[model samples]
Target: MFADVSGPSFIFWPVGCGDTTTVVVSDTEVVQIDINDKLMADEEGNEHIPIVDELVAKLPQRDGKPYLSCFILTHPDLDHCRGFADLLERVMIGEIWHTPRIFREYEDEKNLSDDAIAFRKEAHRRAERCIEEGGDPGAGDRVRIIGYSELFEPGERYEGFPTNQFYTRPGNAITVLDGADVSDRLHAFIHAPFKDGLADDRNETSLAMRLIIGSEGNTLRGLFLGDLSYPTLMQIFEQTHAHENNSMLEWNVLLSPHHCSKKAMYEDGLLQQDVMDEFADSQLSPGYIVASSNEFPHANSAGDNPPHRKARNRYEEIVNDAFLCTGEVSTPEQVQPIIVSITANGIELDIKDYKLSESAEATLTAAIAKARGNSAPPAYKVGFGAE
Candidate 1:
């Protein structure tokens, strides 16, 4: 994703029209948030993106396995969890940070999207396996249920089990869980998927996380609002003020919510000043805005908030520094991820020539050898012949 970020970096994958972000927290701990991996091919049998392969190759590995400190599902949308099954089978996940909605659906046998169902199965399996064993479930077996939902009432889902034992709520500043620190460099503020905010639209249930990269006076803040709508964003702004949580609002790099959706910024084809005021108020000087979508500044596109043409322009105006999109930054041939990192002055996109380092190459080889010896399978490709 990045050209070997020695420090901290957030890699926004260039997967068309979807979201898959890998926060390279450090050399050791890496957190993958959401995944949008759909197989697409051309008449010439050329595949667009071999997402799993790229992820496996790009993500750091140790010993004989590719490892992820945490795999956070912002929300169980198909775009977010499409390749999760393969990821679980392949990568060594330390722990999972997921909302309670998915588990609730799994327990109730509700009509869930196919991808959601797949993730639910794995999450349940891992959780059950952890519960059977003693103490904390190491790595892959561990789970952290983020945000307590009314869906999981007493004698309800996973009845008789202490579900709240692992439930982390909004405003929680989580660093370490299950004997593993998800990030050493970033201070994550869980801002959304609030208990009261849960409604019908899955988008509103998105787990919004604001990441701060420094401490004290010198800090680089970034917010990841997962598919939240305009009203929700307003609510976050209002609550942040009401509670006097300055850290939650201040961000040098703001990942444009809902893929530069007007619904996150505009209302009824008009820019909401109240919300824009929030952006203007909290945005640090020399701010950077990154939209994880394709063909940004899509003025004509409608229905969905993603790639809203006006939204992109609005973000550009709001930041007044750098406003970039995943699709527009990288070339179509070999779509490299958009890497935003903390800089000396402020946050900037760490766009560089990304090639596997010699160390990383060795790790890959070792992982391959180990997997081969164990007769373990690699992560599956999104499409045929992509690998």
Candidate 2:
């Protein structure tokens, strides 16, 4: 079904102030990058969207199983891997991309969140089981070590586990799924979580990458940064420039690290002028700076965690009107997913909603009208919860 579609798309789900991106490589193969499905009770708990349901529905089937080519956990933060163990129970993951520092529970286990611990445990079980059986394993059973931090030396891996792996440290590169085409629509380039910048914080160990999507001669690049800090991002930019790896740095779509956290853009309260200048210098004509969090920071209020106003200004200053926040577009009440399709010409927000029962022709028509950015209120249904 996806084969008919002309280009690759990224459907960023609305999960409050958290992140859950569905990278649709093709109609069939898919990747779920970070998940946050905190349960909500009508009485006491805040209303939260159950994203796993949507992820399972979107994945292409393989031998009757809901098949996800990969499930990448950028880092071990709670917002990144909240319902990961639960998602594993639902679908078959191809391979997991992560770093070793995620396993380190420092300072009496204060470094790792409960969700991170759960995800790490699940990763070990699957990788170990696959090795003991002495055969090729499913996606969930596979773990690809993207980068290592200061806590680990080169070639050091999970404790007591000689499982299958694809270790691509910072400054190195890895093909998407070992050059295994999800649908001939896209490929990936790993970038961050370098050995030199490894610190006790998990955000600094974020596994950043660039998703280059499209056919030959029409590819578009989407840079994905997972909660990377300010100084580290600056360092990465400088290093990439020095090595002449400019292609990896260019972005048609940049997911502002840490959900537009000021900490990633500002030193203390002062804006990093050099960083902002560099960002301004690296636009790919049709670029978009997407903040994957609840309503982006407004000019007035100063927030603690992320979605900071100062960070939003940085993106807005660089990308102009192309800046869009997942929460702002989706709004806070409903938590709608933002689908941006990358075509040969450029990237545009997908007008056609991901309705299971919609006619293809009708969906296409709606998508076109919506792309114009002046369509009336969406009348289509969004069936998101109830997993």
Candidate 3:
């Protein structure tokens, strides 16, 4: 079962304070959400995995070249879109999904990372082709613009670009990807970048969504909220409930927003219990929350960046022991990507026996001996390398 699963799977790479997820929709179809392929990770002493190579090796091929069915950029942040240009050059991407933030950056003359600039250029090219071809410009030139911005107005850059074919607003559901009908096995409900919040903040304009995958009778739901904060999350919760679309908020797996930043649940130095309550309410039994960040500190200092211990504590309360961190799960000797596979029964982790480092092994041995009145420790299996 570890090596073979009949249904779709989600692979979250350990990129250290970044996000890189691959959704294997099927043997022939796949979608990648964000990327942070650090080239320095390939250095001899670096523990990070060279994700681009790993991804290329696993991706399905078309016309004798690596092919990605769709690539979704949640936002233009460097951590989210880093190495995108390299990926684009090496792989044949069928389509791209993005928000208007990329274009807005150019209008504001904000300095963008090279990858972000490349993405913007590619997105603009596809949008132009979409307009020129009238609709559904076929793979490699197809673009799906999520959320609204003035840039997409009828007489603006997106003029005549067939809004119905290319645009998916917040509160809508998308059943097609790159012109392929995935309604039978996949559905993504748009949930953020609300029309009113498309200001200068890139993080606020992130394309958050609830992705449901599997057969109609049995499915796995994952909520991928980019880097949104408390205010927007509160809005999403209230809006979803008001529209009688609470099902869109349900999830078996949730990628903790903003790499487990406290901002997602904190406002003015206070924990927003309503947000926590909503998450606890929406989670299915045996739920899992994955934080794609570096190993969290025991406690965060004032103004410290994310992977915050306080935020992790709250998420732990929601999922109990099912909360996992990509960084903590990976070892120096082995770069373990968290793999959650869908099976005939449901989703399950592809657990592998992790060899503990010498120091870790010694520490565990001492702990076990102390617990047993200083007796020798017995041999034991470590699941997911958890202590």
**Local accuracy by lDDT, each model:** 0.69, 0.66, 0.79
lDDT of 3 by residue, 13-38 (tens): 77778889888787788899999765
Best-first order by lDDT: 3, 1, 2
Q: After TM-score superposition, what is the CA distance of residue 240 in candidate 2 from its true location, in Å? A: 0.5
Better of 1 and 2 by TM-score: 1
Maximum-lDDT candidate: 3
Candidate number that wins on lDDT, 2 or 3: 3
Clashing pairs in 2: 2-27, 93-139, 94-139, 352-367
Worst 10 residues of 3 by lDDT: 378-387
Runs in model 3 deviating more than 4 A are 1-6, 39-45, 107-110, 351-387
Per-prediction RMSD in angstroms? 6.8, 8.3, 9.7
| Model 2 C-alpha lDDT per residue in residues 244-295, reported as the tens digit of each score | 9877788777888888888877886787888877777776877788887766
Model 1 agreement with the true structure over 265-380: per-residue lDDT tens digits = 77787778788878878887668888877765435745754688877777777786788777776653444667766656545666656553454334434554555566544443
